[model samples]
Target: MKKLQFLSSLGFFLFGFLLFSNLKAQNSTSSSLYFPPLGEETWEKMPVNQTGWNQGKLGEFLAWMENTNTRALLILKDGKIVVEEYRGNRLTGLGPMNEGSIWYWASAGKTLTATLMGMAEEEKLLKRKDRTEKYLGKGWTSMSPKQEKAIRLIHHLTMTTGLNDQGVDLDDTDPSSLTFLAKPGTRWSYHNASYTLLKNVLESASGQSFETYFKEKIGDPIGMGGFWQRTGKNHVFYSNARSMARFGLLLLAQGQWDGNQIVTSDYIREMTSSSQGLNPSYGFLTWLNGKSSFKLPAIQREFEGPIVPSAPKDMYQAMGRNGQFLMVIPSENLVIVRMGAHSDTSLIPYRLIRDMWDRFAPVIE
Candidate 1:
């Protein structure tokens, strides 16, 4: 009799647990916000912050780090700035930052280059299908037998020129800059030398320097103020949080500005889509945050997260050296930009997203 009673009690508890799980799944299924597909429209009204929402740990993070040296955090939904905060010291703490402060994009600038390549193609200045040597010519052809075959623009953009890590130490003009370590597009490696070579390719093909082409075309039209400034002898670019936000906005809009269609629709489609076989999650000059499962190189392991798995399967990102990140989630109609000389320089955005997403993602009607 006692065994029968025990079985009955156990059955009741199991039933309740299953019932609760079903209810939770139903709530999650009913959630309107989901992972975004490439080029899917997600433009939403600005200021996702609502009267009542759970910011969770994010509120505590901001409250504690008020005086820190983080540069700027700008969050926009449907093109209106929702969260704009500046902390820490500036260049001598002189001018206040608006949308005018220019931050060196580092490798994040690669996306700009990729987008320009697409624009140039649309204007007939360059063609993706054209062999790289069509312009670079015989001088560059003296590379290794394998290198000669591998010298395409696609190889440069994909970081698969098989150029070894030589440029990590080599100055731009070193003889090794022209060397190739593997056949083109067959390997997955990070080669700044291969990418730097692209500046030359664009110059030769477009008949304009990278700086000039972009300024005359995309930068000026978008109303973004930027300059490749010579800070001392080193040339770098700077723009404020708003400029970065606009850049993200252009991306999330799929290369359209005010319905003007800045970058061709086909190029935007390809930009967010993976090109090389090595990483299905990575696209041309862009890093994908979610997709079918794959292992990242050990260095990239730290930057990825279950965030991709749980957030959106179709999400992609543009990340820069030292953790500069531009995340465009079309499902959320969100373009988030974090620009900073992060205090530790580890490159993690840390609590900014932790707080913002938790606070703003509730989707209260």
Candidate 2:
């Protein structure tokens, strides 16, 4: 009798211990994603040593950034700022370019639109699979009705609209500029015209301006301060460095801000994960890392291997012209934002973040 009792006790104890360990891990993961309170400048901070980042190496990284005309670089780990560096203002056109200065997000704003589109989907304003003409009318594109019908809303989000990018003004909104390249979903091109058309589709579908909808859906909920300003043929978002980090945090949490789920987790997953087959290294307007292959802007070549090998495999980003970058790594509970003038000839921000990770891994290890 005592032996049986002992066996039963051992089984119960093992189950209890396993359950406790599981719960602890869950809590730890949750705790790693920090959400700052709304309407406040206050945000939690984690010490540099806690991240296992060597201070000496970190200083070297900052020196490199300063040498390269980096305006601001902020790194968030477990939802708190671990490293924040600000340098000279080489680009006077974009505000003061200081800590509180507002700078344009450029193409990085596309990620914001993607998030808004997901919210619109949640609200039943529109569907990703819905035909573009469903919202923009049949004649919105110069393509024939048959070709237009095949081009769904998702093509815009995925940059697979089969739109001709040859000799087309990227920011031009005229219907004639949207020339046909191939059938929808057959070809993938980083055509800004297709992406810009999304703004018109969102406005038409939601019965609100893109800015209004974004302010209501994402900006208000997350305590983010930014506005869409008319810049040539595009609407550019300008905000301080902290606001960009806030948005990155929201993405890192999979569209959850604090306790409120701003965008559905499912939509967030689809937005961050691969959206189409053409480019496995891209999500809904976001750049993904650790993919088997990737395609660059204005290039049809598919390079084999992760985009940024030095960064975390799970890292994805919103990159913009002039080196605006917002990198979100879910596995590490990290959100990194860089806003500044372009330091290199290439538009890709991979080198910047790769250099960051190379120096950062030692500290956090």
Candidate 3:
């Protein structure tokens, strides 16, 4: 009787150990994100069933995007393409919006400038604390020398330069257009003219055209191909959707590509997290999703709650006019990119993203 009891006790212990080990393996596999090889078209895929994603629901969501003028929507889970949809045409002309078609990133390109500024700082080409006048010269603005000097390069990155956005030339890069409204760091206003001046600041500091500096520092190294176009006083970035995805992936990996550290980890934290107090939902030209409150473009009013409630609390995004978006969710190991014609104003894309999350939540853990 004693021998039989010992055999049964050993059997129970073995079963419990195997069950715990299997559960651990599944959690580890599901929770981690993947990184693909640079310069390769190949990427791995996580099967829908394995991901706990409902196939029928995903089909319904794609169908809804088709009716909403969505040109292209790509969602990456663990660095692999899980949902890819392309529709509509290029906005400037009638052409199929495929993987090869390039589209403007509009204001979303601000984050690119922010990244370049960080990289330049990493290389000791410029410092964020330096005054704008240091690069653009003493008389570069209409403000008194003292007031102008108060506006530093970091102010440009944080949207706290206190430059007037009510001027006739919002996109103007001319010194006169950069009129003073409030003292630097006293207010938070999304002034395009103030942001566009970073082009000149970077050029003067680095002694390189924006294109050359970007190509050598980021584009060529990561296999991303995009060009900046002069539109009025603003330089807008244009690239295919995949190129945008590659940039998002770079950020998702904390500015690292494969094993190479493209940008310092400290800069990545500063750029993606909050850079100022006035608008808690903004980083260094990047829009943070989860915060206690947020300010919007062309408006001084502050709203309560995260920018996008449905998105993960840690998500940070680059959004543009006409609905271009590159969203990175670190907690979920997810990167989402959307490029299309304008749909709504007043940043209602927050609602759009909320709906997207509602559909994706059931699929993801």
Candidate 4:
């Protein structure tokens, strides 16, 4: 009977040990985020069943995306591809749009530029408080020396340069094109000329071409494939849908890639959060959702409530003209990328976010 009692206690001890080990493994798996291998086409996919999403609803959501002129759509959950589909043809009529096809990021590339600026700041290459004239030199804008000196890198990033955003080609970077409207920090407008000139700021401070600096600092590091294409005076970024998803993943990780701090966490926080009081929804070249109020691009009037009502309160986005979008929702460990032709002609298609979240919220919830 003593021998029997000893064997029973030993069995209970073994069972408890095994149970504890299993629980620890589960917790580790749940806490860790996946990172895809660099320079390879390999990306892990999380099965729909494993994601706890309604499969039927997801199908409907994808169908809705295709019907709305979507060429490529990628959704990542915890750094794993959950929904990836390439539908329709290229907007340029070059060929069918696929995973490898390149598309213009339009204004969505602004977020990328913003990331580079943050990285530059972290490297002691530039300071946000530095005047724009210091990089572009005096008479870069039509504004007087005093007015021009008042404009800072932060003002350009936040779109509060006080430059005349009306009655001129917003993309024109010529000194004559950039006329002063208000004192710096007094007004907020989506002045593309001011934003585009950041290319010069980046180039001047880093002592490297924008493309070279971008590839060395960001693109190559994160395994992203893209190049800055000159479209008239504007330099737009073009890349495959996967490249866009990779960027969103970097933002989701708060500028970390595979245990490397590519961009400082402090800069990332500032880039994603509200940059100024003028527009609560606008970040540093990024658009934030869930703000109390938001002002649309080129419009002075402010609207009530969050930009995307159906999305998570913590969601922010890199939105572009037409339908290009890179949305990051940290709260859900989710990153979504959509690239395609014009869904609408508005300078920034705010409605697409609303429609996407409306269909997307149901499946995830």
Give each model a TM-score: 0.73, 0.89, 0.87, 0.91
Per-residue accuracy of model 4 over 20-112 as CA lDDT, tens digit each? 896575334335668888999999999989988989999999878877888899999998999888887775788788889889999999999
Q: Per-residue CA lDDT of candidate 2, range 157-223, in tens?
A: 9999898888888678788888788988888898877888899899999999988998999888999
Clashes of each: 6, 6, 0, 0
For model 3, where is the 10-residue window of minimal lDDT? 24-33
RMSD of 1: 11.9
CA lDDT scores, all candidates in order: 0.61, 0.84, 0.82, 0.89
CA RMSD (A), model 4 = 9.5
Candidate 2 TM-score, true structure as reference: 0.89
Question: C-alpha displacement of 309 in model 1, angstroms?
Answer: 4.4
> The CA-based lDDT of model 1 is what?
0.61
Between the candidate structures 3 and 4, which one is better when assessed by lDDT?
Answer: 4
Candidate 1: regions farther than 4 A off = 1-58, 64-69, 91-98, 166-173, 229-236, 293-311, 343-365
Model 4 lDDT, full chain set: 0.89
Local error of candidate 1 at 207, Å? 1.4
